[model samples]
Target: MSRIAVIGAGIAGLTVAAELAAAGHAVTVFEKSRGPGGRCATRRSAAGPFDHGAPGFEAVTAAFAEQVQDWQRAGWVGADAAAGASRLIGVPSMNALAQQLASHLPPGASLRVETHVAAIEHGAPAGWRLRLLDGQLNAGHFDAVAVAVPAEQAAALLAPDASLAEAMRVTRSDPCWTVMAAWSDAWAAPGGSWTAPDPTGVLDRVHRDDARTGRVALDGIASRWVLHATPQWSADHLGAAPAEVIAALTAVLAKSLGVHLAPPVHAAAHCWRYAQVPDARGEPCGWNASLQLGACGDAWHGAGDVAGSRPDGVERAWLSARALARQMALSLTPD
Candidate 1:
């Protein structure tokens, strides 16, 4: 079996690692965060589990849809986020999906969280050496390495591959500002549901976190709201302090709802620097069979879907990861 190391434990990393492991290759996933699911995140606090990142996602492609169905059957996904719609969310929290995927590593496969792989080098005879952020190198000699981080971060790691580096340079990621607030009182929800996509003002999406299915219930009338600002707005205030961001968004929320509303008991703001690409070129994944090195993520996707309805960012990540795994498997002999 080929020994492989996947950097970044986000959806792409986990998906590729899992697929390779299932194909009889020994794979190990490395994540820089305390947990997996970079954007599929949830912050735990006294007033939380706030879905500050990737509130929910949709499964557009048939393959991803089938996979989503499997996740639903396995009790990892539910449609409570968008009532009567196919939009699905991780049960309890968005992070659960990544956690679930990372948790189920069969023999010879493993996951390592909170580990930062600074760089990778290909020596003449020693194979691939993973350099840690702490100046130490991973002891294991992996036959292959996969990079599944955002384009900005992947650019440096993929510099040796001129084509991949150019692709990364072309695929630029934009920023986003998200504010999550919680209250202990009731508020007027839009049409009795708590959501507004492409509504009227500076916001792109406003969702009621607690209103989704599988979330822990509150005793009295309460609300957990998550507000996602438009890409332009987020970029304008990309470096704003969290406190200032929270205050600004809270006011915007009140104005957008056209209600003074109850004061929030908890509120916080998060910035996603690499949130999306305004124009996704839908590039194919990177794989060098002779080198056994590869790269894949939302930045590298080949969405052949119909013109009008292309796959979203989340779906692109899965597609890219799966494509990379399939290519790698084709190069390796099966047991």
Candidate 2:
């Protein structure tokens, strides 16, 4: 077994680490945040918790579907009937899914949260070296490295490697501005979830998290909603202050509801810089044999979709990580 380093503790990184560790390889994951879940993010507050990133994702392939079934059995995830019978979300919070996946990693595998890998320094006498954000720390001499971060981030980390660099160039991602709003006891929510298809649009969709998961609750509160701005709108106001974005999106939400809504009891705005990749191309994952460097994420491969219907996010990450692990296995041999 060989020692390997996987960067970013998102679904992709966690999948790669778990699969490699299961194969008897010693693996370690480095994550920038305090916990797992890159875009599968959640924010907790005195008001409650909010899944401001991805609401949920579809399981396309049988491999991913089986994983979801396992999670369901373990109570890590559940079907959101309000969103759709097929739609699945992490219980308690969206990050719970990543946390569960991280927990299932093999005994030899370890996760380092709140650890940022600032740069990758290759060409070491032993193997690749990781330059962490903390100047005093160092990690290196791995058989291989898997960078399972966003395409843009992967590109930056693998810039010294030509093949991986070219592979990430084709993928293009967009921004998203989201608002989490909760109603006061005085204002009753209309109920249910909605997806707006208005041609003259400022918003993309709005979902009732309370209906979907019932994970968030505040005293005297009836319902909560996460409003997502359209890609175009998000791009136009990408740099706008949070208050400005919230105000404009609230107006859009009012227009969608066709009702004069009262002020929210609680409201917050979050910006996702690399939210979605509308157009992306390349292999399911990329690896450089010479440098033993690789990358995998939902942004890799073709339009990360299932039968050209559902946009593959969580499932795609799983598939890409599996592919990378297999490649790593083939390249590394036991001592």
Candidate 3:
């Protein structure tokens, strides 16, 4: 079995790790965060669990649809018919999908959370050496390394390679200003969710957490809403402080609803610097023959064909991960 190191614990990383492990290869995943599911995140606070990263996932390919069905049958995810487009979300939280995938890794595979791999370098006989954020190098050498992070993060790690860096640079992502608010009983939700197509508007979509998951009320709030600012608006306000962004977005929310709403019981703003992938080209993944380095993520593929009627970012991540794993597996084995 080949010793492989997969960096980042998002869906892409986990998918690669699981695939390699199932193929009888020893795989170790390194994640910077406390948990998995990079962009497929769910934040829990006094207000409740907020799906601030990706609202949900939709399958475009039949193979991915079958995987989603497996997740559904396994109770790791559930369908949200109200979301339309066969959208599905993690049962307890969006990260549950990543966590579940990690749990099923083979005996030779393992995951390391809160371990930030700062850099990767070729170590001659050792193949690849991982430099951690704490100025220490990982003791184990790997036959291959897969970078399954956002384009910016991947760029930072793979800066030594001009071609890989250029490939990552070409794929651009947009920032997002997200507002999570818990309302009192005074104001009721208008509906499950709403999207604004106006370019000038601050919000692109507003989701009612209570209606989406039926779990927000447990936080002792009447209703909860997640307000996502449009790409242009988020870019315009990207430099603003968190409090300022929250205030402006909250005002925009009420205005967009065309109702005079009271202040929320709880409100907070989160800025996702690499929120959505607007452009992607070349291939589903990038790899170096001599360096044994590769990159893959949602940013590898564009928003998908057919515009608004295509798969979401999470599915792109999955597809990219699968493609990367297939390449890595083929290379590691010989006839």
TM-score of 2: 0.93
lDDT of 1: 0.81
Number of colliding residue pairs in each model: 0, 0, 0
Question: Which regions of candidate 3 fall more than 4 Å away from where they truly are?
Answer: 197-199, 214-216, 302-310
Candidate 3: 10-residue stretch with minimal lDDT: 302-311
What is the lDDT for 127 in model 2? 80
Residue 281 in candidate 2 has what lDDT? Answer: 56
Those runs of model 2 whose alpha carbons end farther than 4 Å from true positions after fitting are: 134-137, 186-190, 302-311
For residue 309, model 2's alpha carbon misses the true position, in angstroms, by 7.2
lDDT of 2 at 28: 88
Error of 1 at 301 (Å): 2.2
Candidate RMSDs in Å, in order, are: 2.1, 2.1, 2.5
Give per-residue CA lDDT, model 3, range 8-28, as digits (tens).
999989988888888889889
**113-184 per-residue lDDT for model 2 (tens digits):** 888888887775788778888764464567788999888778888887977876676577889999998776
Q: Which ranges in model 1 have alpha carbons more than 4 Å from their true place?
A: 81-83, 191-201, 219-221, 302-309, 333-335
